[model samples]
Target: MFHIVFVEPRIPPNTGNAIRLSAATGADLHLVEPLGFSMTDAQLRRAGLDYHDLASVTVHPGLDALWQALLPARVFAFTASATTSYADIAYRRGDVLVFGPEPTGLDARVLEHPDVTDRLRIPMLPGRRSLNLANSAAIAAYEAWRQLDFAAP
Candidate 1:
């Protein structure tokens, strides 16, 4: 399975929806702290995610810890500023597909990290801020799955 890493995720509902997506797709979901809301919030639960969704979610204390756990996996960060489209990358098992928080996006330091395998973006009309967080994740994940032929099935 591929890894889906959300960096400093802010909105509960976005993360919640992402949880459902991750579970259905069999991707491991990793949340890097500090998150803006409690994962236990009722709104999170109301976002169509059930307790089973949490089974695929893993909370890491910080980026450092996340890196330690997910080491050796190439990370392709999804950012609006990236010149390369997400489709250009060849994703493999153990590759990490990372998304930034909703409000501000990934921190510059993290985005420029030497360990980041690549920076990618989903093409949009000029002047658009971005696509919705959950929507972006779904698109990227599905494309990666497609590249893998949806994993033999």
Candidate 2:
């Protein structure tokens, strides 16, 4: 399983859907907060996530805290400006797949962060800005899982 990190997510259902994704895929979901909605543990569970799904999500106070927990792992920051397509990478288990907020993608600082092994992007048509937050994550997650033969214990 991989780790899906969402930075400063603004939407509620996007994160809720991600919880379900994590539960199904066995990928742990990490949220860097100052979140757009009130996201208490009970609130998350009430959002239709069972205890198992909620257990797959971890909310960090900030990027620094996220780094503390996920470092020494290959971090791939997804951004539209990235030259590398998401499919080009040979993703592996434990690799951290990072995404930004809904409106704007990853900030320059994050893309340039030393810990980021590289920056990646999901291909799109000529004029598209980006895909939905949860959608992009699912695409990448499925691809990575596919490469890993979709292993499950």
Candidate 3:
């Protein structure tokens, strides 16, 4: 029941890959406004995400729309500057795992929003750049699912 949210994602392939991850994990996928490409974009649909994977995808005009639709679920912002590692958080069902854009990352305003429960980071090599957005989201989602004992029927 976890929700994977991407804020103003800039790359189509990354988002497409995320959609596949969502479908595989049974997580709802939310995409915020100002996307770099359309859902019908050829590249996007061809990036290993099939139409079935898009079944659970939801497009929000803005963060406010997402807020309204996903209320009561705590949002955990994933940022490179965070002090707490993502694994340290006791993730729960229905929590929203929020990620940022490819190059610029999350907006400070969004990261600091009152609704965001906490900021989390993945430990990386010292002085290294951030991991690819899709990879980071997969790692976070898998860890959260792991903590849930790989929930399944």
Q: Each model's number of backbone clashes?
A: 0, 0, 0
Candidate 2 local lDDT, residue 110 = 85
Candidate 2 lDDT score relative to the true structure = 0.87
Off by over 4 Å in 1: 51-55
Q: Which pairs of residues collide in model 1?
A: none
- CA lDDT, every prediction? 0.85, 0.87, 0.87
Candidate 1 vs candidate 2: the lDDT winner is 2
Clashing pairs in 3: none
* Model 2 residue-pair collision total: 0
Could you give candidate 2's per-residue lDDT for residues 70-122 as a string of tens digits? Answer: 98899999998999999999988899999999899789878889999999999
- Candidates sorted by TM-score, best first: 3, 1, 2
RMSD of 3: 1.4
Candidate with better lDDT, 1 vs 3: 3
Clashing pairs in 2: none
The alpha-carbon lDDT assigned to residue 134 of candidate 3 equals: 89
1-153 per-residue lDDT for model 1 (tens digits): 898889998888888888887767878889999998987877777773564544488899999999999988898988998999998888898889889998688878778988899999999998999898889999988988888888732
lDDT of candidate model 3 versus the reference: 0.87
What alpha-carbon RMSD in Å does predicted model 2 have with respect to the real structure? 2.1
